[model samples]
Target: MTTTVRWHSIPELVRDAAERFGDAEAVVDGDTRLTFAELADQVRRTAGAFASAGVGPGDRVALWAPNSAEWMVAAFGLLTAGGVLVPVNTRFRDEEAHDIVVRSGAKALLVQNGFLDREFTGPPGVPVIDLKSDGRHGFLGSGDPLERKVGEDDLADIIFTSGTTGRPKGVMTTHGQTLRLYEEWCDLAQLRAGDRYLIVNPFFHIFGYKAGLVASLIRGATVLPLAVFDVDRVLELVEKERVTVLPGPPTLYHSLLEAGGGRDLSSLRVAVTGSADIPVELVRRITTELPFRHLMTGYGLTEAGTVTASRPGDPYEAVATTVGRPCEGFELRVADDGEVLVRGYGVMRGYLDDPAATAAAIDPDGWLHTGDLGELDAEGRLRIVGRKKDMFIVGGFNAYPAEIEGFLMRHPAVAQAAVIGVPDARLGQVGKAFVVPRAEVSEAELIAWAKERMAGFKVPCHVEFRTELPLNATGKVMKDRLS
Candidate 1:
């Protein structure tokens, strides 16, 4: 699914969207509703503000804020002013956020003041712009849009993903790659014009920033940004605003399923979710019970934009078991060691200012060595087995936590499950399961059930019940925390 390059830069897309979808709702944040033209107008003014603040081409600016209309304007505004966007995780503590700011060499910081009760004033001499208050008063400068020498090949954002070396590495991506990737994502995910998109995923993630906001801009969809993910609040918004598109991890849908029984969610027509192992029964329930006309699961990482995704009319079995075939412009292959490798237009240019690391990640041949383990079927569809680093050896047999977690989810009592290898004197390493159960079930019963259903080595040696598992902003279990 190679796509024709539409508008070259992010600024161009903002202008084009306004021209094409003028007077249409572009964003809905609480009582504030902005039309496409209005949003573009604010973006330009905000860009002018940034320009006045000494930001220029190639300069980096860290945006540490929660999801909101202001966050949207601030991001496009920074890009329009020719500044590289470095979105900091909202969940990060003071030190974490500041580390990215200092490492990215951000010229300025846009902090959501009073958010989470912490003031995010950057290091001395760096200006901090409060996104909420400044947008209305001092930050929204009244001037014509600044003429920035921005191009498709110019760096647009430096998103920091967790690195294997303990420090976060900034993944650099150009405007052209971002636009083209999400354009295909919109096509595969069935995001169309006039759809109201609820962006529950944090804006720091690639899926939230690119797939959520950029895809909406490409398709003229109205964005409804949620800073927080409250199941009841999400349900109310879906019913009240008639939200048509909802994309998140599998856990989001599961929460909705549990809480949205009586709620009117008929407006939700498109859903795309992935990130963790999905229970086949859950997929069946979503398709059968939910009002979504399209439900898809995909596999992607921060290093690559969306790699592969199930289509709208794919069989339930495929949708449940596999993350589907390679998306347009991406080529995928499995290595002999079971690691998934991808080469694509959507691959990041490199880690920021780290040539040695970049060379190691992307070989001379251009294949990005994905640390994930997967098996390609006869039709070239991929079924992700586990992460290469996450695989643990149980005695002599290799045990994948994701594979075991899937089997555990099949149990009727289990709502969520996570498995981590624990050292054992006898087996060398055994599985310890953490379960969030929907029904009362004893640990002995679950262990007994697992022993009958799976190989002895595969069965968990220990089970611990919990009300909820630790989830990151993207809804993936924080397995590191579990360990």
Candidate 2:
């Protein structure tokens, strides 16, 4: 059956959850806790205050803050007022932050005092509203409830995708599309009511915002937000809150294995991880050593929330190997050039204010060119090969960097690795490895290790060691910098 939803907009979706799970713990952030019923009430009030402040339907409001309970209230508050939310990366430099706020034409901004301990001084080109101020709460909403119903196509949020070469593009998503995709994601991932979720992913990212908070609301799970990702803090929260579901990047799980010794990790029942360079060895250790009952991985991008996910009962090898079949209403097919293309509700409507780029991304036929290269098997599972741009030709053979990076990670000394194609005189092009070592390991040894495991074409001729690979806030290695 195709994906379907009863709620038309985000406010309605939240209202349904609040009514069904009234009085249940909806959110927990350190000392601040709110039940579903109370949370719903606050949302209406916040919306009323926004309305009082002149925010109306279709207005764009910027929210620049780290993960906190207030962030949740502010986000839903904007939606409740029929305003579109524009989330800013908490780690963005002042210049980057200014560009997004100005480019999106944000009417007002809800900003924190400081992010990562650095205060944002000077003009931000918009009316900046302090998050900790009474301004958000002092003004009272009309006593009348404002749960205005909206259509499925109503603009919910405009999330900017960070591009390396140029300015970020705002990807537009509607309320109905997001709700439907997560409904499939939650159902396939077995997210249930009463499950304690420890969300370490940043809220600005779709994984944390939709998959973390919105999914919890839909499934009636308790959300425990982590402002910062500290290994010790994650362990402490997991133990204290009895977190049952934790989904994060591979680095999160890697740290857990390294530092989680002797901790009460038995409460961890579900673990979800995904990336192009996921190693089978990591998946093996997670299943064998970790106490998680279900280990799954998924594949998605900023344009699409979660297009595919591994099933709960999938074989451990398959779970580690592929990013499972497409979610309902989503169709995945590889292009002749080996690029992955998908068409579904989860795909963003368009790139805001950039029709030429949108036309390039989503063809007239409606297939969204994903730029990712992958292969789908007869059983419908998809094995992500690598980025189409990252594939290198070695001695006339096409060698995907992800395949080689995964092989290099199997080495005991290698903790993280990224491979980029560098120009070569003899082979026309060759692979170079930028590696983050687990310990003091020589590049010579790592190159020798890769030679033994992978084919000659896939082996990196050059290896460079980094103390820590340059990563964006969302944990993806900045391959452009390496190149």
The model with the greatest TM-score is 1
Lowest summed lDDT window (length 10), candidate 1: 135-144
Which regions of candidate 2 fall more than 4 Å away from where they truly are?
121-125, 134-145
RMSD (Å) of each candidate, 1 decimal:
1.4, 1.9
Candidate 2 per-residue lDDT, tens place, 43-120, comes to: 888887788777889899888888887888888878988999999888888888888888788888877775577776
Question: How does residue 209 of candidate 1 score in lDDT?
Answer: 94
Off by over 4 Å in 1: 141-143, 163-165
Tens digit of per-residue lDDT, candidate 1, span 1-483: 357988789999999999999999999999889999999988888888888888889999999999999999889988999999999988888788888899899999988888878787787767888888786455864445774768999999999995433688899999999998888889899999999999999998998999999999999999999998999999999999999999988898889888988899999999988764776777877888789989879999888889999987788889988999998889999999999999988899999888998898899999999888999988788999888878888888999888888888889899999999999998889999999999999999999999888889989999999999998788888888786
At residue 42, candidate 2 shows an lDDT of: 80
TM-score of each: 0.97, 0.96
Q: For candidate 2, what is the TM-score?
A: 0.96
What is the lDDT for 85 in model 2?
A: 93
| Per-candidate clashes, comma-separated | 1, 0
